[model samples]
Target: MTGTFKKIRRRVWLILNILVVFWMLAGVLCMQVPPSEFWPAGFVALSLPGALVLNFLFLLYWVFRRSWLLVLPLAALLLGWNYYGRLLAINFAEEVPKEAKTLQVLSFNTHVFNAYDKIVEGVPQVSNDMVDWVATHPADVFCLQEFYSRVNSIEYNNFNRIGTRYGKYKFVSTLETDRIKANLGIVIFSKYPILQGGTIHFLNKQRESANRAAWADLDVNGDTVRIYAVHLQSMSIKSEDIENTYSAIGNEESFKKEGRNVARRLKRGFIARAQQVEQLLEHVRQSPYPAIVCGDFNDIPFSYTYQELAEELENAFVKAGNGVGATYNGPLPFLRIDNQFYSPGLRAVSFETHYEMGLSDHFPISATYVLEPKAAE
Candidate 1:
């Protein structure tokens, strides 16, 4: 009877260890493969946090059991240290005096400032709050995604108001949807003079009106720094999709359909973003000046879109931020989709994710950088 119990326990332990091995391999592959090579890997990448947590539990279990199995997860963790660092960091906070040479930049996805809100009584209250926030917390550069404004509409003139409020700064935007009555796109307001600016449109047939990258060449204190404010391919997960996902407990058929829909959307987004990243990287490489890229990437830290960009630029969050800097504020709170990456020539002094204001589905991210003298020259 005791032997039978011991045999059962051993079998369960073996199964658990096998599951850990599978997840660990998947997590490692996520860091190595680009979604361009195999799009399915991107989905695996998204499950990395879950894999990490499970491995941690396994590590604890093996420690208590005084078994040599602890080495499996411990080695996997050590091997994936670079990928883990991008998701979370431990930095001791210290007072770093603001220097005259530092450039402060903020990136935010305003979600049209809740202009289409129905659940909320006041439609534009969030919009008004965001405007007020921008007016007060001024930065050298503001890269905004999903920015919207309606012509002659008092409540929707946020685009004009923001530009007028920051009158001294140069404002550049890509008007993807330029209708007679309204406009929607990405915008960049820079304290420095904008010498040149343009947009890089994705060639996908199913592209959204706001899916594109806008860039500006700013003359910052006699230095020409090119900055790209980009909005990548969205997952297109509608409210109904969220509802279906949550309420799929009882109906098996409905659950399967909803799962397929969500997976299809994600797969499409991954492929489109892969193509977009290649084009954007080409554009960045052609730039004559040092570059700083900021906006809602719509991809997590372990994604191919991030890996490609990180290969060319330095992530501001990984450099100066502390903790899991999750920028996406939604049902899934652990997603840090919005990001800021700068050329190696700039040093990130500070990085912050603002979550206090619930104006949009994304938390605003800001980073201060000091340009190296040689790069500035």
Candidate 2:
């Protein structure tokens, strides 16, 4: 019995060594795929451990052996992923100019003027608070997602006064249903003449709510600059989902089992966000004019969504704002959900977070951008 136990222990060690080496090689092969293919690539990359665990259970089989020769390939893959991330970071900073009439733009989720509790209830105000915020802004152009307005339907004419003030403004709704006030919508107001504008809603998998984009062609100083407003999916994890997980249970055995599952779900959400970002990337790639993308992305700086969307655009706050630019008005003040991105011809002179404003859960974010007309073309 002692001799048999010793042999089993030796076999386990050998299996672990082979598995580790195989994982290293798999990581290398994974690096060959681009971030654009991150969905399929990421799914496989993320599921490897589970697959390997099963393989480890069958360790007595000779088929479980790993190819040690793939070590070099695995190393190459690790370096490739690292390099890809670095390249993306570099691209994000490439469009920001050292110096250029700064165009000021503001983007706020506005929580539909109903705040967090209001959003939770799925009911929001028509246009009173949003009109107030819009009226007070000093921005050359303003973009807002989750904009709600049912008051100015010719009968009420509540938002007429506010709407008439702007030279050119657009209010686009992804969902036309009158049932929910702030379902899927976006609004853009500009002091400059708006030549044209349109809305693009994402491929709705659930067909429940709209994840959308709105854009406007603004004629500024005889040049056309396109502005895009985006609001991706919510990253909120359900409380019930958390409770069902073993990690949340706080037991040693269950903790290890459920902790990884919770993390995996979070990672899946991040990957989904990245996929949504890929849509914006396609739009940006096709853009003919210098562009500005501003809105609440439901993401943070270090996230894949932020990093990918920012690949060729300059983040306004990083250039001009001081401190941790948090925008989501929650218990945590470090959430910078609101953001503004512009092309390389634009210079971010200043960026501010209106923390003093208590009207909405999200603090309105504003930035003054200078566009080099000569370089814009």
Candidate 3:
């Protein structure tokens, strides 16, 4: 009986080990394949960090047992090593040299300035808090996503307040779905002069408020740095859908319906983001000056969208951030969805994720870049 129990346990471990390794490998390889080609790859990449944790546990178990199966998890990790920094980093913060040419850019999604949520007493109205914080921030350039404003009233004068509060600033914006003399959109404010700027109109906009990219070419002294502030396709998964992820007993049918609904949204987001990123990348390719891309990507670090961007530019967090550097604040935690990607010519001297500002569903991230001045042209 003891021998039979040992055999059953061994088989279970073996099966689990094999499954974990497969999932991890799938996530590693999926970054190169677009979800438009294989949609399931996006879902697989979503659980990659958790899958990595499980694989580590299995590795330890195998090592303690003096089993050769330790090779499974070990091989999977080595193969996925390229993505290690994207998911986790332990580098110390970098220091900006005094008098060095530096450009500070802050990117955030303000959740429409907490307009629809109840304002809690004494807990800091996130909308007011974010607005005030941004106004006083020292960043030379600000790229805001899901930016809200009331054009005709002083009630929601975020644009005028932030622009004037800081200093002399120029603005470029892409406002959509205006109603009641207000608008929801993306914008960029810069203390430096903007040489040129405009919006990248997405081909598909009606499905779930697919956002557009706002670009501004700012003249930092004599160098022109193009900044692209983008908010990609959202998964459209609501709070209730997250709550009903697992149906109650005797409501299996309802649960299944919700499951299908969530899956459909997820698949749609994956494909749409792939299409959007391709379009955004083409714009980057046409950029005559060095580019800085930042905003709420709405996709994970291991997705096709990030991979494509990383191939063209360096991720600021991976270059300078410490630990997980998670920016999303929501029920599903530990998601590093927001990012700052920049051209290789620029160095990320400092990177910070302002997780303490619990004002929005996503935390604000700022990065300071140092670049060599161009020769007198």
Candidate 4:
């Protein structure tokens, strides 16, 4: 009986080892591309775990076995290469800033009117808190997603109160939806003179949900700097999804339903986001000046949108930010979705994620960039 038990244990371990190996290979090879492609779909279909899970398992395996050989290779397969890439990007930013002109940009998703209702009831101080946050940051250029304001509001004067609070800044406000109750949209503010700026309405909504991308041309030392502020399709998994996910931990029916909903949302979100990213890619390709793309992407760092944007520009956070660099304003923030991506000629001098202000569901991200000089135009 003892011999039979030993054989059973050996068989179990062997099967588990094979499964782990297959999992690592699948994640590393075919599905390693940006989440905006076929790979993300494949991952979701397989019901494979996220990077966070794999990371945790990798560390736990080492803890139990005390073996560097197996653990180190797993780490490399999981997240090592991306981390190294981020390091190299930071090194590149550090060296380039010393020799060029600088531009500071801020990106934030105010979460539909400063997340006031989400956090508390009758929070009149929310607007003031937002103004104060911006004043403290003092960015050369600011891009705001979910920048809610009064309906039928026109011109930069509409935001005069907030503008005065931020040292009389100029801005271009786009109407995502013209409703007094919601009053939600995007606004781009600049201390630098705005040569030209406008809205790129992606989804014309009767109900007003999917509003994305704002464009601007700022005069940077007599050169044109194109800026694209974007907010992509959300993960679709809502508050109920979170509740169901937690409740399902012990309850079987709840668990099955929650799992199915999560899988459905993940697949749908990936496909829609990939389409949106492809459009943005086309926009970037057509841009006629040095570009800076900044906003609350709403997706994690590993998603397709982030990687696609990075192809044409350098991510400011990965370039200069340190630590986990999360920007979501919540009880336990574990991801960096707000980002600033700039042209290769631009260099990031300083980058920071402002987390102290409690006005929005997302914290603001700011970065100072240096524009390289040229002999010609």
Tell how far residue 278 is off in model 3, in angstroms: 0.3
Over 116-155, each residue of candidate 3 has an lDDT whose tens digit, in order, gives 5754452212277778888788899999998877666575
- Predictions ranked by TM-score, top down? 3, 1, 4, 2
TM-score for candidate 3, please give it. Answer: 0.89
Clashes of 3: 0
Q: Report lDDT per candidate.
A: 0.80, 0.63, 0.83, 0.65
Q: How badly does each model clash, as a count of residue pairs?
A: 0, 5, 0, 4
The local lDDT score (0 to 100) that residue 254 gets in candidate 3 is: 82
Residue-level lDDT tens digits of model 4 in 1-377:
99999678756654565565565455444334545447354353233334335544655765676655455436545554663344223333355535467788888887654444533443222365675566566678878787765433332123554555565445555654422333456777777677777665554222333657878888876877888888877766666677768878988987988898887787766666666766777887887888888887766655555656766678888778776677876543466778888875677777887877656778888888877775585
List TM-scores for all candidates, in order. Answer: 0.89, 0.64, 0.89, 0.78
Mark the 10 consecutive residues where model 4 has the least summed lDDT: 149-158
Q: Write the per-residue lDDT of candidate 2 for residues 85-168, one digit (tens) a residue.
A: 321222132344554356788888766555334433554434455556666677888787776555425422323434564544
What's the distance in Å from true for residue 230, model 2?
0.7
> Could you report the Cα RMSD, in angstroms, for every candidate shown?
3.1, 9.6, 3.5, 4.9
Model 4 vs. true fold: TM = 0.78
Highest lDDT scorer: 3
> Which structure is stronger by lDDT: 1 or 2?
1
